[model samples]
Structure formats: C-alpha cells, structure tokens
Target: MDVSLKNRFLKSYFSFSVGIWFSAIISFLSVPITSWLIEPAEYGKATMFSTIYSMILLIVLIGTPNGFMRLYHSVEEKRKLLWSSLVVPVFLSVIFFGFVLLFKDTVNIFLAGQKNSKAHLILVFAVFFGVLQTFSQTVLRMQEKGFSYSALQIVSAASNVLFVILYALLISRNFYAVLYAQLFSNILALSLGIYLHRESWFPIKIDKSLVKEILAYSYPFLLSGVVWWLFGWTDRIVLRMYSTFEEIGLYSAAFKLVSVMSLFTSGFSTFWYPFAYEQYEKNPNNKELFSKTFDYISFLILILALLIMSAKNVIFLLFAKSYRSSAYIAPFLLLQPVAITMAIVVARGIDFAKKTYWYIISDGVAAAFNIIGNLLLIPLLGAKGAAVTTGLSSIIVFAIEKAASEKLYPVKYNSKRAYVSMLILIIIASINTFFERFYVGILSSLTGIVVVTLLYNDVFRKLMKSFFEFLNRLKSMNK
Candidate 1:
C-alpha cells in the first residue's frame, strides 16, 4: 500500500470536513439572526415551501447528474452516453415543472398555508437554480475536481448566509429571505460550476452511447432520490394536514436543525467518490481504505451528533422554546448521517457489481416500507415517527445494497471498530440527553468526544502531515 495515497485521502478528508465546518458554523450563527427577526410561523412557511420544493427538485433533476459521475471520461463510447444523461432529464424536468405549474393552486394547498402567489413564482427560479447547482457540482466531481467542488459549495453557503442575514435581519420580515437567499446561492454556485467546467478541461461532447450507460445507471438513482425525498421531507407535509401551521413550523425548525449532521457526509461524499474510485481502480482488494473510511466516518458522525445534541439546551435557550420539547427527536435524527454514509457505500458497491437495478429494487422496497411505517407511526408518534421511519428504511435499503454488492465487489467494514465506537457515542448521547444533571452530561459528552477523537487519531495525524505538505507545494508553485 502506498502511504502517500493514504495521506492524500486523509488530507482530502480534512479539506472536505473544513468545508462542512464552515457551512455548519455559519448555519449555527445564523440562528440568532433568524430567531430574532423571522417569526416561527413565517420561518415555518419557509421550511414548508422549501420542503415541497425539495420534493420537486428530485423529480425535476431526475438523477442524471449523479449518474454522470460514474459514466464520465472513464467509459468508452462517451458521447451518446452524455447526451442520454443530459437530454432525457432536461426534457423530463420541463414536463415535471409544467405539471407543477398547471396544478399550482392544488399544489399550493399542499405546499403553503397561505398563498403568496409570489411563492409559486419563486419555485420556478429555485428549481432552475437547483438543477444548475446539481449538474455543475456533478460535472466538477467527475473530472476529479475536488477543490473546485469545495470552493463552490463554500461560496454558495457563504452567499446564502449573507443574503439570508440581509433579508431576515435587515430587510424582509417573511419567508422571502429563504427564497432570496436560495436564489442568490444557486446562481453563485451555478456560476462557479461553469467556471470549474472551463478550468477542468473535460470534453463536453454528448452522444447516444454515453446516454445509454448513464440512463442504465441513473434509473436506480432517479427512483432512489425521489423516494428519499418523499421519505425525508414528507413529515412537514403530513404535519401540515393534521396539525397547525405553527406546529409544522416547529417541526421544520427541529427537522432542519437535525439535518445539520448531514454536513458530515455531504461535504465529503462527492469528494470521496473519486478517491474511492481511484483506490478501487488501483488496488481493488485494499480493504483498509474502505474499513478506515467507514470507522472514521462512523466516529466522525457520532461526535457531530453528540456535540449538536449536547449543546441542545443552550441552543434552545437562544432560538425558540417551541423547539425545546422537540429535542427528544435528536437521538433518532442522529442515525441519519450514519445511514446516509452507509447508503452511499452500499449504493456505490451495487453499481460496481453491475446490479444497479438491484439498488432500485432495494430502495423501492425500503421506500414502500418507510411510507407504510410512516402511515402507521406518524398519527400516533408525530415527527418522531417520521424520523424513525426514514431511518429504518435507510438501514433496510443499505443492507440490501450491501448484500447485492458482495457478488461484484466483496468488501467488509471495520465491524468491531464501528460497533464499539457507535455504542460509545450512543451511550454518551443517552447520558447527556436523558439526565437532567447538566454537569454530568457535559462532562460525559466531552469525554465521549475525546474517545471518538481517539478512534480517528491515526487518520487525523496523517491528515495534518499531508495538509502541510499540500500547502507547502502550493506555496512553492506560487513562488
């Protein structure tokens, strides 16, 4: 095994983490601004509309962007594949968006408590920008443009925070802040994506063969992404029907807050793809890379959830008490990051195995299970039920993916390391959350963070060394 490759992966991991850290920091800091100026009801509308828009995003984008990653320059017969990837989704989005617009009023009932008329208008731009952001980021990653991806995401996040601060704190009093911020962020990200496309120097030709492979790969992704959106975002819609708009607002706040943990996986996942592909291409049997990544990610996500959950009281004290009671949902929500990372691993493995359809099948089964679980659980359990349903489906889907992938690419996780660390962090969260004793919870959480740190310590040191060397090389090039 090449030590340098290991170091490179670690360095890449840190860079990815730093991006998420910045994004999360800005998000945490934005709370005070949001809570002070935007009323919970208004923010709730923002959340609801956004959630509806999220569902639309999956339908509009149609998963071609993700499929492009696997079918990029590496595949022979690239042109047809590229066209297949791009043309079909572009046409589908037009039809999808048209359907949305035609039934705007009925959809508005599902999407918003009060129709702004303008809200529907905003959705157009939001979905348009979202496709740009998604496609641009995908293209960047396929070319192994990690730094470009990171930079664009950072820029988008920063711009979003700035515009949101401007609107929420300075100018507007309503959900326009969300809309405006989203618009600006998407435009900025799309621009960066365009810039990186030029910089990456990849061929842009699209053709039939490329499209065939892309479609073949992306059909599973398209279905999976749509199902995931439904599974993930359905709570707000469900709550909207059964509960008050304000309740939906509270739930949205809680939901978005919990989603913060996803920064761990999202920030690194795109970047990890090329690294993993390179590793597999070079040394298919190097179990250490996958094992280490899993353990480190497991440790990383647990620590993230612990830190967020540990500081829940303080956060609630500052934001809204309505959300305080909802903190109980934190435990189930923490499972999401693990589930997402695991899902990514499993999905990738399945694709590697050439059983892409099995992925679609697995997710379809899981999605059905999730919807059924939600229908049964949500009326009684509320948002908590939705969280549990989402998580259970994720585990089920991941298990199926893992099993199916074994035939094509046999891989094993660091089971002992993952299990032990996972248990430790879960215990830590239980102590911190269940006990009323703040000092004990606080101390135990800190200790737990340290323990999690220890799990990734070797990787962390190697990362630091690699980073400094990377920086040094950059400095030399500049000179």
Candidate 2:
C-alpha cells in the first residue's frame, strides 16, 4: 500500500471506529448494569422486543439502504437517490405499524411474551422511526461523513443509557423500562439523524423510475433478509420454544458480551461497503487490495476472538451471579461477529458483480443448518447448544459466501493461516467451556496466542516495522 493510501484508510477507519468504541463501551457497561437492575426472565422478555423490532425493520427496508450505498457514487442526483430509497421503506413501515395495531393482541404475546398494548405500541413506533434513522445513517455513511455519523451513534447510545437509568429510577423497573427506553432513544436519534443530513434529504421528492431501479437491485436482499434473520435469530426463537425465559436471558447476556466484537465489525462494515465500492470503480482489476485486506482483518478478528474467549469469565463477573453461566456460552458466540466482519471483506466480489442473489443461497443454507441444530441441541444443552449452533452456522455462511465470491471475482486470499488460527481459537473456546477453571483458560489462551503469532509472523513483523517508522515520523515532526 502507498503511504498516503495507508494513512487515508487508517484515518477513515479510526474516524468511524472511535465513535463505535465509545458507544460500544457505554453499551458494554450498560449490559451489566441493566443485568443488575432486571431479573433474568424480564431481561429475556426485553430481548424479544428487539427481536420483533429487527424483523420489522428488515421487512420494511427491504435492503434499500444497501442499494442506496451501491448507487451513491454512480448517480448524479444523490439526494434524489436518497429520497428514492426512503419512500418505499417508510411507506412499508407505516403499513407494518398498522398491522401491529390491528393484530395488537397477537403481536403483544409474540413480541413481549405478554399482552401489554402500551408496550406493543411503543415497539411499533420504534420500528417506524428506525426506518428513517437507517436511511439517515446510510446517507452519512455513503457520503463519508464519518465524524457526523460517529457523533450521531454516540448520542443515540448515550441517550439510551440515560433513559434506561431514568426509567428504572422513576418508572416501573421491569421489561417496560427496556422497551420504553428504546422507543424514546430511537425518536431522539432519528431527530438528530435527520438534522445531520438535512441538506441531503430535506425537501424530499419521489423519483418513481429511480425507486423502481433501486428496488430491482435490492429486492433479492428482501428474501435474503428474512433468511438472514432466520440464520441470526433462530436460536432465540427456538430457545423461547424449548427453554425458560431465564435461560434466554442468560443467552442474551452472553450474546451481548460477544457483541463487543461487533464494535469492530459494525464500524468496519459501515466503512467497508462504501470504500470497497469506490475502490472497485477506480480500479476494477486491483485484486491485491482486497486479498490483503481480507488477510489483515482475519488476523485481527481471530486474535480478538481468542482474547475475548479467554477473558469471558472475568468479563461475566460484572454480571449478576444469576448470569454467571453466560461466560461459557459467550466464547463460541464470538464466531458470529468474526464471520460477519470477514464476510464483508471476502464477499466484496459479490456486491461488486451485482450478484445479490448469492446472499439468499448463503443465508438460506446457514439458516436451515441453524434451525436443525437448534431443534436438536437446545433440547439437550440449553443455551450452550444455541451458542455452538450459532458458531457452526457462522462458519457455514462464511464458507459459502467465500466460494460464491471467488467464483464471481477471484481473489487469491491467503486463507490457510486464517483457517489454522480459527481452528486453534475454536479448540481454546471448547476447553474454556468445559474446564471453566482460571488456570485452564490462561493456559489455553497462551497456547492459542503462541500458535496464531507463529502463523501470522510475517504480518506481525510488517505491522511492527510500520509502527516504529510511524513513531519516527512523529518524532521528526516534533523536532
């Protein structure tokens, strides 16, 4: 990589990542705090509300956010493109909101695990506002307004924490606190998002032909979205069926801890799509950048996964004693983000080639595997079963996506070392789960670290040399 290009990529990445890290830190801290305030069953019920919200968001958006990003630089009328993306999703969101109202009783039971009309209404509004927020964020993302985007993210996360504290202090301290806090926070975040992108999306007007074009590109993702949801959330749904809310709560807690991995994944994905698309447009044949990026990301994510797995017990200590068992479940759950982050890098070819349909096949197969795994395993092992199933399903998704992408636009990614590192991390996770001893975790972590370091020795040397050179440059500037 050129020095200038490397500097630009690092600057852009940190511009987005800094905010994500702060927001994630707040969210990370809040998980234990919320766990302390709410019981396991109540926390589990709150998780269900988010589950329903995510499903509705997926249906209403129908993948238009991605369509907008893909077409952003290609189109001259970028504002019109933004408006085109928003119109249909907002319309669909209204219809879904109405449906929620019409079928309030059923939605209440399914979403809240009980019939609370107020909570149901709040969830409906949350999804509605969330649609607007999605487009607003996408606009910032596509435009590379990293600072503004990061500010919005931080504000949203902070407000949610504040509201959760307020609700617990003044309002009822049950699942309602969680549900209500989310609704209020979404409203606040949506308002800020609209304000941030006001110049881009205000005076919005429909572009019928453009809307049709964007929809054509994004429609496959609609089917894929549903399947993707199934792949991601089937464990929760299955857990709801076969296990207690307490078990679900424990699982959700573990999942939240694992989501610290998403701090990097989400920030990277948010940046990757726009960056990758732009790079492809400029040099369609430059495969080395993609290959090198994949190797570096895989190396970082694998190392992070191992470290998190080793520290799971210590991390879970912040949770209430009732949630302590979550430590065991969290190690394998690390795979979910690892797969997602790497897939964004490895599967860039699919998006570049406009082969969105591959997502359907990849997610469909994984979802099927997950459904069967959950059915068989949740019956026997409870939350641990779900964690293991999710981990394995993630690998399936990554493998299928990588193969499809390679067929579309071949990149000679040096994947052998990544695979070896992943295997070592998996073994360490399994040991940590079964042994549950501090010394055992330490020994396994040390072993995995040694093996991964040896495997990626060349990459590490390059990074270290770059770091010292960067430091020398700083010293020269100071002089």
What are the clash counts of all predictions, listed in order?
A: 11, 0
Q: On residues 44-72, what C-alpha lDDT tens digit does candidate 2 reach at each position? A: 78887888788888898999998998888
Cα lDDT tens digits, model 1, 1-479, are: 37787667666767656666776777777777777777887887888887777877777666677676665546654444445566776676677668768877866665565544567767777887787677776666656556766777778888987888788667878878877888889998887677656543245566666667666667766677776666665666666656566655555666665667776677678677766665666676786677666665666576777787677666656555666755654555565577667656645676555466776677788878877887776787676666666656766775677667765676676545655665675576456545656577668878877887787787567657868988999999999
Instruction: Score residue 65 of candidate 1 by CA lDDT.
Output: 72
Candidate 1 lDDT for residue 342: 62
Can you give the lDDT of residue 457 in candidate 2?
Answer: 86
How high is each candidate's TM-score? 0.78, 0.90
Best by lDDT: 2
Candidate 1 Cα errors over 4 Å, as ranges: 34-45, 76-84, 97-121, 161-177, 199-204, 234-260, 303-322, 361-393, 416-479
CA error at residue 79 for candidate 2, angstroms: 0.6
Score each candidate by Cα lDDT: 0.68, 0.85
